[model samples]
Target: MMEKHVQEFAFMKCLPALTLAAAMATVGTMIPVASQADTSPHSGPAQATASTQYPVPTFEGEWAIMAMDPVKVAGNRALGPAARLLVTLPDSLQKIVGQNHFSLSRQSGSAWQGKQDDLTVTFKLVSENSAELHISGKENHKLDLPLYRNN
Candidate 1:
């Protein structure tokens, strides 16, 4: 009975320390949530997921293929025959690329391949700002185009 009393006394002595430790832990967890709330515009269910990160790098803006008028386009000849190709990834579709773009070809590593209606679209990222786009249209028309980010 005497030993039991001593043990209870020890626990009583440590109670305040244990309560402080639990409070500190709760505050530590809340700090990150508070900071994340301030930094991120979308929280809770709207937060971005792993799938949102899969869109081709530098492929989120407006891009136009080379034009015949070299002076207007600043003579970006790497465009080659793809001069007629125009690619646009509006902000709306960029967020759900997997459900939209990946439906056709699915995402190959570092690239996206898919078919929309009669056009077969393949996008390969060469760099952050440059990518190779291949489109095969109906009637055997094929365009192997290099794309550059415009915006």
Candidate 2:
């Protein structure tokens, strides 16, 4: 009777294993395999395109100096000066006038003068988004400050 009881317990365990294997086989056969050639329309390479050009601003006006700073000149003990210029462009570039204001100073023994005035201010528009101002009037010498379009 003990041998019969042991055999019955072993059979019960085997039955569960058989059922699990059958269930996995059924699931595997029901699922479909995918192919590699399925291409999506939005997955293609982006086309090459040209960027739009921005309009340039006209440089013609009476500008005042806003601020100035000293910059190190390459290989020179003296520092280069930078100024913030306010300018109003004229209808013609030939009749342009501007002002430059700088906050730059040179070393005690350095041969540099920081200055900003009417004679030192010069303005030029490089592009619609940028402009260049040259200042050379006071203790500070030449400066080139890039200006962006306010709009």
Best by lDDT: 1
lDDT score of residue 130 within candidate 2: 46
lDDT by residue (tens digit), candidate 1, 107-141: 54345566767767676656555667666768887
Evaluate all candidate structures by whole-model CA lDDT and list the values in order.
Answer: 0.51, 0.41
* Superposition error at 2 for model 2 (Å): 99
By TM-score, the best candidate is 1
Off by over 4 Å in 1: 1-57, 68-106
Q: Residue 62 of candidate 2: its Cα lDDT?
A: 31
Tens-digit lDDT string for candidate 2 (93-126): 2223243233323221211233444344444444
